[model samples]
Each structure stands twice: as C-alpha cells, then as structure tokens.
Target: MQKTSYLKELVIKNTHEKNGANNSKKETEKIQSLLNLFSIANPNSGTGTSIDGDFGPATEKAVKNFQKIKNAAQTGVVNQNLFDLLALPIKKAFEDPIQGSNLRELIVNTAKNHLQNNPFELIIHQQGNSGPWVRSYMDGKEGSDWLWCMGFVQTIIDQASSIQGKNFKSLMPLTYSCDTVGVKGIEKHLLTRYQAARSNPSVIKPGDIFLIQKSNLDWMHTGIVIDVNGDTIETIEGNTNSMGSSNGNAVANKIRNFKTSKIDFFSIAPLV
Candidate 1:
C-alpha cells in the first residue's frame, strides 16, 4: 500500500473511532508539536536533556538526570517549561540499534531487513470469474492486502532461513500459555515474542521475541531485538505499534518505540 493510505488508516486507529473530540484533538496537537524534548542525544553522558518530544525512556531518564543536575530534591517530574520541553512519552521508546559483526548483529540485520520489506503484507490472493488471479482476503474481510501475527512470523522465517529455518520448519504459535500452536500444525493462539526475551533478559540475543499486549490477556504482539547497547535495546515488531501512526507500516510496518514502563501493561519479552 502507498504511504499515504497507510498513514490514513493509522490515524483512524490512533485517534480512536470517534472523529472529533476536544481532548483527543488537543493531545494529538501536542504530540505533533514535538518529536524530542529536553534531552541531549547522549542522555546518559550527564550533559543535560534533549528537547525532543518522542517521550521514550531516554526523555524520562533525562528528566531525572536534569533534576539531579540542579539538585532540585530528586523528583522525576517535568514541569511547565520543562514539562513543555520534556513532556515525553512513557508508552514507547526507541534507541539506535547496536551495530556489530558478531552473531547478534548478524541475526538482527537478517531479521530486521527481511521484515522491513514486508512484515504482514502477504496477500491471501483471490480468483475472479474472468479467470484471473487476484489478490484477496481470507473471507473477503479486512481486504486482500492485510497481515496478521502469523504472516508476520512467516515473513521472518522466509528471511532468516539460516537461524531458524534449518532447525525448525516453522514456529508454533500458542495461546493462554497452556496450548501449543507451532507454525506447520499448531493451536496455541497466544504464543508471543516477548516470552523469548523474558526468559533470558540478562542476555537477550538478536532473534529473541518481544511479546506485547492486545485486547486479550495473553501476549499478542512480537518483535526482534536488533541491538543491545549498554543501556539501550532497539527492537523491530508488528501489530505492536501501540498507537496507529504514520511511522508504522501495519504488519511490515516501521518499528515504533516504547518504554519498559509502557509495556509494563503486557509481558514485553521474547517467547523463546
């Protein structure tokens, strides 16, 4: 789909079903006003904060750091000018991917690049009376060009042939933590990516899964950890964009940022 169409659908999702509300419009206006606020690029360097308003963990840390810089009691709060400057997001966060030639980077790039091209853009395909092969949806619902979690995982499998392909034909998705739904012939509806990372938070590698929340209780979203710097870890995922935004590409959508604080609502680890 074109970027414009993608963005239109996203705005609808992010803004909620209701068209116009005072508070909603105001909030949207605020977010649009800034990207990064009150924090230097290297926030941990102790050089103060950057004024960007993306509101990931860095801004939160920057706020705390700024408080420490001024010795202003020790509250992790951002006020007025500082609030306007540092009113960052707690729901999402993104840090630069750690670069390397090591196994982690190799796997991350393999996964990231592959998914970036088409995460959930797989078409179910359609057949027309004119005897033409057409792109169609599974029950003629949600349309022909739509992708869900299964497609998201499959795309990665096609791309990361070396890492998981040879060992396992396909990954089994599960649901409610008690079922089993392997890719080829499985049934667990909720096996998520987050469980993979949580099991080994101390040493999360590139291919680990990062489970995020959906309407149900079990993990519903997934992502791959691309980099793991000293304190920052960058991930690429789908359906877990949290908010509907232009930055997201739906399934093969662009990865969005989130803070550990934000994902606290759901398990945000790899489901190994």
Candidate 2:
C-alpha cells in the first residue's frame, strides 16, 4: 500500500464527546481502538474503554486523560487535530528524510530512524499483532497470522530504496515470510548459510538481512543488520522483544552472536 493509504486509516472522523456533536459510530469505534493502543504506556487512560462504537462516558474520560497527559487542551473532544495528535508516533514512522548515499546506508539509516521513533504493535480486542504500525508494515492487514518481523524489514527496505528510485523487488520478491526470502536468496546465490557465515564473517555487511534458521529449508525471524563486530551483529528488528522471540511486539535493536546462533544471511550488497 502507498504511504497515503497507510496514513489515511489513522484518522478519526467527526468530533466526539461533545454535546450534540456528530459522533459517528465508526469514528467512535476508531477512537476507542486508538485509545486502547495507549494502554501499554498510560495504563490509567488506556484501560476499559470498550470498543463498541459508542461515545460513552468511559470513552470521554479516556480522551480527556490522554489530552491531559499530552498537555493539550483538556476538553473531552475528538477532532481531526486531536486524532492527529494521538496518532503522531505512527505518523512520524512513515516520514523518511533522505540521509544516505547508497542502499546500504539508506537501509541502515531508515531502520535506525524507525527505531528512534520506537514503533510498537498495539494490543486491540485482546489481539497481539493488530495495530496501525502492524497494518502499515503489512500493507493494511494485521492479525495473529501477520507475524510482522519480515514485514518490518521489507517496509524499511521499501522506504529506503524508494528514495533512491530503486525497487527492492529487483533484489527479492516482496514477502512476509522469512522462509520465502531464504529460498529467494539461495536461488539468487545471495544467501550465506549459518555455517558459511560463521566461517567467513567478512561476507556479511551492514544493511544485509539476518534470518534465524530453524532448519535447512525453514527460516523464521528476520531483521536488518545495522552493525557488525567480530561474531556479533547489532540489528533493528520488529516483532521481537528483549527475549528475542520472533513474534514479539515492538521494533528494537538487538545484539546477536552469529557464531553461536543458527542465523543465515541474505546479502543485499549485490544491489549496490
């Protein structure tokens, strides 16, 4: 999906929580959902607002609390401006400033920019992998099935390459599956198998991708290779946490030992 479409859904229509205001049901539901996303950071304002498409007292309280926390006008109202304030983090995630001279530099810098933005998957309707960030990366689809590790990587690649007027699909098919990416890498002779990477660490570079190998044919989680040192690589990966589970919640920088972990490489240097 285009950036416009990705951002378009982040909006909330009609003013809510005001007497005689046009509180459309759809807009109310959207407001409730967006408010719930804050539950991870601001528990007091983000809890127990039912997403039933109703502009009730609970939703009003949540809106006012969020406004107070943000130091905005503490009027219990929902407008486009207020919605923009609420969705600012997700909005800034897509605004890439061109800052690199090459694909590798662009990729690493783009990933770092997103890491600086601190994108987090939202917990909605008690679902883990559903949120504006997830949908933006997944091209408008988000749910349990959309494990977004590869989606996040691809989004970074797309954003960076687009700045260079290049297409990442020229390197590999745009895909959400690490296994598919691994197969493509092998077909293109671009993959450095775990043992091979361990043997010749010099082959991997910054901006390459690291795939956690489950088996010869099955690769699982993936992330951007931002920095390399000896046997360790620093990565900016999504859907992972401090524990390094592939299906984690937010984008993070992680340190991995390629010599010790069953990790493979998909080199993008050929694109340079």
Candidate 3:
C-alpha cells in the first residue's frame, strides 16, 4: 500500500457512519484501510475485514469488536475516539505483548532528545516561557505559565507518533492537569494504577506515566518512566529538578524507589 497521508486530511468530530448501503466508497475505503491495519496488528482479535471499500456486515462487526475492546460505546460507528485508536502505530512495542517490541525505546529516546537540547533555559518572563521547543509540545494551547510536565509528555508522544504517522493526543487524553491525566486515563481505559505498598515493579514499564500522590484526592506531579528494575524506576520528568518536586526548576532525569510512600499510583498509556 502507498502512504497517502490520509489521516492528516481526515477530520473527526462526531461519530462517522459508514454502515448500510448509504456509505461512500472513498470514506469506506479509508475505514477499510484502518480496519485492515488493525486486523493485521491484532491478529487473534477475531476475523479480519476485507479491504473491498464496502461497508458490509463484516466491516461493521469488526468495528464493533474494536469498540468493545476499547471500552467505547458499542454503536458500531466510528467516532473521534475510535478513529484515534485506529490511527495508532500497528507496530507498537510497549504494551501489547503480542505484536511489537521496543515501544518504550521510542518513547524514552524522544524524551531524552528534548533533554539533550535543554529547552528549559530558553524561558523568558515576558513571553511566559515560550520557545521553539516549548511551543512544539504545548500543542498551540498553552504558554510557559502552565505546569509543563503533562505538556512535556504530550509533546514527546506527539513527536514519536508523528514519526509513525500517528497522533499521540488522539490516543490519549491531552491535558496539563495531573489529576485530569489520571481521570482521562481511566476514562479511556488506558490507565493502570497500583498502590505503593502493593505495586509490583514488573507492572511498570518504560514509557508509562507515574503520578505522585499528594493526598487522597490530589496528585501533585507526573513523569515519564524510562526504565524499570526491581523496586526502582528511572524517570525523565519536566518542570522538575534535583529536589524531585513536580514544580521544580527544570526538566531532568530522576530515580525513585517503588516503595516510596508518596507515590500514590502509576498509570500506563496504551501503546498497543
């Protein structure tokens, strides 16, 4: 198949209907392409749909199955959320145990690349900490005043996804609030949280996001996991420093023990 860059041209707002005989061939073809890719990536996920560019019962069934797996509304119609999931890289390396490898390496490398450039030093008070690097990650939505840990993670994922012709924000919630990040993860069924005392280090993988719990109802910090060993995890965090506070001075790498009491829970974004 030729790379047509069709995803960039497709606009998703509400649910897209391609069922019955009323569907357009061009639109159905796009949907078929996505379903074909999805079927290939997730082979054991039941029967595959033919790329005939026709919205038959088989295509609708495949879409419905995908919706069920994603915990989305089983309307059998593709929506913005479903569209985003379909756009993810078929060759995921992080979460899915079946199809791919080295997914964490892609995420960690992207974060490290930003660290090497040291974009935090480019902050200016008048401009509210805006720079080429910062702006690229901000998604045209925020300035420097915003706590940027979420932005930093979002930016890194965005960069990595673009390289694969996918959209990271579409796959996960794009928010600046730590609390909201957790909520979005749960809503999207992509969040996995473990208690500090009961958590197993093996469950934590590189490229996952960890939330620092400040209280029962509040999470004060977040970072990207780069490496996970027995009871210890290394992170590349934004808006942090040597002190390890979420609102610290700059982006830096830090190591922490899984037994830390302050760590309320950690969440993993779906990359499979």
Candidate 4:
C-alpha cells in the first residue's frame, strides 16, 4: 500500500515539477486520485523520487526505458499520453486490473524494445495507416500483410512475460480478442464515437475508445479511453479509415444519446 500510495504521490509531484519547480498540494492530490487506477508497470524501473515532486533523471530514464519497451515515443517528458498510461495505480484491488492493463502497456513497451534492439526498423502497427510498407517485409515474406492489432497486443504480452519471468497465454483464448479496420475517406460506417456520444452521452469519457459501425446501423468500431466527465468521454481511437474527418487521427468520439453501447470483445471490458 505504501508503494502504491507513494507512487500516486510521485505522479502528482512529477506532473507539477514537470510544469515547473512550483508545487501544488491540491494538484498533486487531485492528479493522484484520478490516476490511482494505473500501477507501476515496471517495478524494476529503479527508485523514483519519494519526495521533491521532481521527475528526475532516474525516473525519466526509467520512463524512457519503459516507453522504449512499449514502443511509445521515448521522449523523457511525462506528456499527457504517458501520464494517461500511468493513470492506473498498482495495488491489491487494482492489481489484477493493473496486470490486465499492464498487458496492454506491455504491447507498447515491446514495440519500444523492437525499435531499439532490433536490426530492422520495427514499425508497430498504429490503428490506421495509408499504406502497406512494413507489413509486407516481415522476416522473409513479401506483401505478407501479416500484421494485426491482436498481434500488436500479443507482442506486448510476450514482452511482459519476459519482464515478469513467466509465461502467459500469449494469444490465449482466441475469443478474447476482436478488431476491425476502416478508412476515414470511406463510406458511412456504424455510429462513430461522436454518434454514440449523442445517444449514450454518459459513456463517453476522455481517453476512452469509440467504435463505429455502418451508416447509423450502430455498432462498436473504434477503441481507446482517455478521460471522462458527466457527459463526454474523450478518447484515442483507431480505424477512422480516412472518412475525411478533421483532427489528426483521433476525433471527438462519444455517446450522443441517453443510452450507452458496449463492445462484445475483451478490449473494452475489464478482464479478470
């Protein structure tokens, strides 16, 4: 509990210290409360600051190492995305979920590892892309199209097991995973994250994922949860599929009506 407690404290301090040398007790407390769902994905990341609120070299290096392992940008700065990743704290109650969540984190970490340790340029699959450059050249295959989101998730699992010195059901029960691919400039799909928001306004949370099905047909398509309040849930989703939407890759996803829709796969729901 102390480590859990301390880690939360550290995040608040780190976030503040990141802003400046200035300290905000309220800000620290608030951020910790919000991020308590995340845990220390890498315990061996070395000792972080117990006080002083500074995200020092050790912590930064550790995070960079963590990011490198997750295949995320290895910038040492504790940005919003990285901070969101660390939102779930590691404790007994949250530990199992953290473990499951860590599995997700593991994916990013492994991608990071591949980028650094591998001889070839490792392109971990981002949700949507315009071309097929990397998928075609795996090991000894041409035009293989051999990449899948589940594959990306599995890479993380393999790496996580390595870190924990254990074996996990990498692909596990095949039923636990499901994914879809779509383009933005394409035709009308299911309810976009935006459509769902209008219907089930309560379900949309920041950083949460949005899944869109066929034209108003309504279904889950995208995924990623970032933050949430009473009405809207902001998220980072995949498979916008070039529908000519604004914003870079992510858009304002949500539940528009009073009801919410749930995806059938294991991606959105919590795993035991």
Ranking by lDDT: 2, 3, 4, 1
Candidate 4 per-residue lDDT over residues 121-222, each given as its tens digit: 121223222111112112112121332232223333444444555443422322112332222212223223444455555543322234444343334343
Write the number of the candidate with greater lDDT, choosing between 3 and 4.
3
Q: What lDDT does each candidate get?
A: 0.34, 0.83, 0.61, 0.34
Residue 261 local lDDT, model 1: 18
TM-score per candidate = 0.35, 0.90, 0.56, 0.27
How accurate locally is residue 129 in candidate 4, as Cα lDDT from 0 to 100?
20
Model 3 pairs in collision: none
lDDT of 1 by residue, 137-213 (tens): 11122333233343334334323433432322234432212112222121333233334334444454455444444
- Better candidate by lDDT, 2 or 3: 2
Better of 1 and 2 by lDDT: 2
Question: Which is the leading candidate under lDDT?
Answer: 2
Where model 2 places Cα greater than 4 Å from the true spot, the runs are 1-5, 18-21, 24-26, 39-52
Candidate 4 lDDT for residue 84: 51
The list of candidate 3 runs beyond 4 A from truth reads 1-101, 121-123, 126-132, 140-144, 194-198, 264-269
Model 1, CA-based lDDT: 0.34
- Leading candidate by TM-score: 2
